[model samples]
Target: MGRAGHRTALMVAACAALLLAGCTGAQGTNGPELTNTSPVPVSPGSEADPTSSPSSGESDEDGDDEAGDDAPEPSASATETESGPAFPADTKPDTAEPTGEGETFLSVTDVRVAAHDGYDRVVFDLDGTGSGKPGWRVEYVDQATDDGSGDAVRVDGDAILRVSLSGTAIPTDSGVEEFSGDRIEPADTESIDEIVYRYWFEGYTTAFIGVDDAERPFRVFLLEDPMRVVVDVRH
Candidate 1:
């Protein structure tokens, strides 16, 4: 062969060997191989959808805020109202106390009269050794009368309220009159005019309450602790 031809053939052989070496690695792979272990970073515009639903933890916080804004306040309706007690108006009512049906010594201590919104109240305080209330019957009479002799007792106002108590007497077992105050208590106010102290005889006593109204409705009741009889007259 000629010299130039020989040189051209050698160059072509060397180029082919280099190409074959590049095609295989040390483990004898067929083509170029990649062992990329690092993760590829994404661009800003290629991030997740901006309008998508949030994660569970973030979603719960957002939902709570929305629900709180929509929550309702307490109701002020009248249907959910408080209840109260009912009391009687005028006329005779059930006996308020156990003031009668027993035999015991009762003495008068003090008498007080006061005017109220719906009625005029008269309180008769009784002092006794035993634990018993004085039984009384209060009725409207033309005139009050003195005990035993039945003499007419003059009291102020047009109507007289006779109070006859059963379970008590003025003088105790020691024969001492516990009450020394005046029998006629002047109360020139409201329906009541005067309070009269009647006589005590045979384990019994009588008194009078003078009110201005003749046809007024009245209620009688008894109190404890200090034992007193209360008369309420509707104005």
Candidate 2:
């Protein structure tokens, strides 16, 4: 062969050897060879999918951001409402004597009436420079009469209950303001019809409680710490 042809043949032989070396390396490997492939980076010790749900530790950390997640809800009926006293069976009258001194200088300051579930309550609040508590005399009467003028007072209802407060004094003597309101007719009461208050006369404060039909069971008691007289009448 000529010199140029010999040189061309050598170049062709070298190129065939390089091609065979590359194809042998690729075919001899355990896995198929890939072209222009990029390897994905993974964390050091992680086993879960990256695009899937978070791990347990990561989920708990997210839950910490939300407050009161595991706390119990408050109950709707945790507190109970208070109820009034029961109705009395006795129909007799009640009375109590004064405490401390013979003639207390107490003056009637206010009068309040409220109805309960089974009875009606009337409170006579007293305040003054008295030495002790006040006394009371309560009973059923055929007619209500005024102590100052011996004249009969017109009262409503079929039965009349006379409430006489002893050891009382006039507004001038007690150094306290007397109740200025006249009649009180409670709308929520079941038995009591009306209350007519008379002025204090001669160390006694007299009042009339008009009741429905016949006389019912009644109870009278006195209390201290801003003195008061309480009357409970059954329906």
The numbered model that scores best in lDDT is 2
How do the residues 44-158 of candidate 2 rate in per-residue lDDT, one tens digit apiece? 5455445555554564435763456677876542111122234357655667777766446898998888886677778888998857889899988989999967899988888
- Structural similarity to truth (TM-score) of each candidate: 0.54, 0.61
Clashing pairs in 2: none
RMSD of each: 15.6, 12.3
Spell out the clash pairs found in candidate 1.
99-135, 106-168
- Please identify model 1 stretches exceeding 4 Å from their true place: 1-103, 174-177, 183-188
| Candidate 1, residue 172: lDDT | 48
**Which consecutive 10 residues in model 2 have the weakest lDDT in total?**
76-85
How do the residues 129-211 of candidate 1 rate in per-residue lDDT, one tens digit apiece?
55657776777777778777889888877777777766666564523355555455544458777777765776656777777
In model 2, what is the error at residue 63, expressed in angstroms? 27
lDDT of 1 at 19: 84
Backbone clash tally (model 2): 0
Candidate 1 lDDT (Cα, 0 to 1): 0.64
Candidate lDDT values, in order: 0.64, 0.79
